[model samples]
Target: MSSTLSRVRAAYARVEAVGRPEIWIDLRPREETEAEARAIDERVAAGERLPLAGRLFAAKGNIDVRGLPTTAGCPAYAYEPAADAPVVARLRAAGALVLGTTNLDQFATGLVGTRSPYGAVRNAIDPSRISGGSSSGSAVAVALGIVDFALGTDTAGSGRIPAAFNGIVGLKPTRGLVPTAGVVPACASIDCVTVFARTLAEAEQALSHAAAGPEHALPPLPRRRPGPWRVAVPPIGQLGELDEGWVAAYEAAVARLTAAGASVRTLDLTPFTEAAAMLYEGAFVAERYTAVGPFVDKLISSGGEGLDPTVAGIITRARDIPAHRLFADQERLADLRARALAELSDADALLLPTAPGHPTLAEVAADPLGANARLGRFTNSTNLFDLAAVAVPAGEVNGLPFGVMLIGPAFTDERLAAIARSLEPRVRLAVLGAHLTGQPLNSQLLAQGAVLDGTTTTAPAYRFHALRTDPPKPGLVHVGGGGAAIETEVWTLPAEGLGRLLASLPRPMTLGTVELADGTTAAGFLCEPDALTDAEDITRYGGWRAFLAGAEDSAPSGVRGTARSAPTHPHAPLGDHPTDE
Candidate 1:
């Protein structure tokens, strides 16, 4: 079989194994999708350079996929679309085959997946929990690994909440970055075409392909700082009644960002919360009525056969919102946007829990509207303020996935991606002695393809010691009180490389997270408490290089530790260590 054929077959098998029938509302026939993939393989064989060649994707039901009927989760409301939506067409043109159209909340109205006639889309990780909505199925499909990436729409958290629930990456580009021409808009002004995938790079890749449609590109926001990025996080009190576990998960994610080299500042999230309320409470919701008030009214009058009661209530209620009230809401939103923007003026992005909490199916069933509203706490205001966002899985809580989102002002999509990339699995190593430049073990790091990030010092809470080894080595130990800052170098490499380096590590030295003077932490060398028993305390020397220099100055001419005067190598004046010492 051809590569595309093989991949398509494997995907079909995985889809069947997942057994979540609600994930897809409309599936293109297996033969038809395979035919499309086969054509792409043929084109590649004929020398085409399709970026998404052989990749598979699913479009949310609200998004037209040419062959599938656009059902915004209500059969009576669905229609035969004349063509693929602009975003969908772009991905297809890039050689991505559409697997089908996925289920979602009716008319993309609620953040809870239960608001769908097709069926409630259950969480991929915990079936008894809500999967989030209105981009519900698209997020789960990606999370389940059924598709390489999937398309969803974001307007008041539809895109991000689902990704958070499913433990995947959901990237919401600037409002107009990806055209929504053929989508059944929840609110035209706020609707954004988004992509969900298993990694930041995959989501970014899909956005790059989808955004290249018919000239919708905008200038990206410039980075804020020249050194380590600055990220703002909301104060815990402002996060509502978030579960302790979720809050701890959010804090841990922020710490990871800090440990990966970001300066974090506590931010007041009041402006953001106030703006988010306007999405469903203020006249801004009138846009939903404007989008499909007539059809919903027709259904309501005929006993609302196809309309979700909650969705109908929300849409119908906004029908009589005075035009002046909308203008007032717009003005208020402008004020909040100004405040939120000011708070983020010097930061690359704002990081927060993707949702205040994860609700189980029973909780959502008992209080659908309330549960849905809570899920949008950190997501709704994003579109209202015209910000770009990327939601990513941030470890798990109680075996269920937890997530954090990075939100930035409009046109900061690329910058958000860069910040999110820090959350990936790469590891940073802090080398204090043997692994420093010009040192004996420096070759091992270079051999593993590690790159020297920069030179720095440990926090003033570590003691430096000289281990009594064949070739003396230094050991770093955390001493809560009487420690002093010690010189060190930080190097970055893939996680696999770090594991390989650890495999051959000698006795007395082990790896642990080292606190740096700048408040960041990195994996570095440390000695066992027992190894410190007979080790010489070299704390006063401040560093191995300085101690070696002092020893050379006072030693006899033939002393083993003695070396010629520092070499002309400008990279290291004193030389962290002599290669043969």
Candidate 2:
């Protein structure tokens, strides 16, 4: 209970600190939100196992929240919703409280976040840059840590672009998969509700809850085909005019994926890009006019009081797309979709840059339409072809954030998510003792799904000792000058697994950063000064494995005492030590 309240209080504090009021269209009263968090705490105290217990989240303004006006980023379009949108309701039922409604592009029309009459949602990382939109507010809120996650609507990369620009995870489920019953649609048939979170796990967690309840629009969850991972990427020539930084970041991501055991394949991405272009350029855009044209018409009739000129121009003009053009475009889309999906047929997913570039606010101001269209170059095709995607932060391109998307067939959300998880940042742990490969404690790492990274020796700045404990262990302590280069093994695993291991590790030891002889540093085990009082200094042996070999040769066969103990972390992988065995 206290945890929930503390988090809520901290969230409110963050909101106040962010200094960006345009990120929200309506921020709920702090006290009211706290009260709700407290109530959730009480429910948990009663032995409930709510998945989203005590979680605080935000909803995009286009998503209806009871008592909050749905502005869709234009104040004149605002109206109080009588009830929560199904997605919001589902999250609330799972014990999450909606912190507020966030800002977006007007009528969810623009991809540059500047279309809102309220104000543009600035990039959380660099205020000078534009935050990708129309899911602007939701992405910024999550990026700033003001909320655990936020709900957004995506038709043409609104969900992904902001997330990429903000350096967060954006998970957009298959089109119409999560019910859109209460959302103010930009293109009703193609609009998808999405989740923005700091990590893939958290984003997926929110999605698990949001995808439940009444009026879901999809087939049952898909059973992924069993095989080695084969991910498709665009051919080098197809990359066009990307900057060196973007190209490098993307190649680095592929390298990381390869290291994580995925085979990479190249596929021509023209069909996908063409279909993406059609979402806004073809007669398909007429769907947006059908959604809010009448309201725009009424507003224009009333002296054009509150329309954003760019958004108005897009939607109003969409109304005049000839009827035959609409059918022709549909036929065109069908052929394109077939070609695109066919290329993806033999692969697990198609990986691509989340956006062509991250534009600064000034750059966007100079060419709003062109900049936004460019942002959608890698994104706009998903909904047009009923695909599922998960956008992940790959690395930085120069100083700005760069992201990549893993797109797969519709209903393959979970599969794409699993592949994306492999590409997420990982932790490399160095161990000088017990947890090494072939040791009794090595099973801990294996159990946690950790894989052996490699072996390396520490920098000559540590003293190694064999501790006197039930499970004889070796400890390495940084000694600055008199230390020797100690050998260690490195293992890599998910950050979550490392956390679980850290929590279960026993005392007198720690998982601290260790400098390797190769000039790299990694999380490694170290012991406290006091714990080494009566321990044997084995630095001369260079490593625990060497010491163990010497002891076996010198001691009698029966002298080896068996006193095995648990590994440092519950879920960990480690290296050799001076064990009696």
Task: Say what the RMSD of model 1 is.
Answer: 12.0
Which residue pairs collide, candidate 2?
435-574, 435-575, 436-574, 436-575, 436-576, 445-572, 501-569
Per-residue lDDT for 346-448 in model 2, tens only?
8989999888888889988898888888888888999889899999889887787899999998888988987987876779888777777666577556544
Score candidate 1 by TM-score against the native: 0.75
The lDDT for every candidate, in the order shown, is 0.82, 0.82
The candidate maximizing TM-score is 2
lDDT of 1 by residue, 82-105 (tens): 888888888888887889999999
Once model 2 is optimally superposed onto the true structure by TM-score, how far is the C-alpha of residue 54 displaced, in angstroms?
A: 1.9
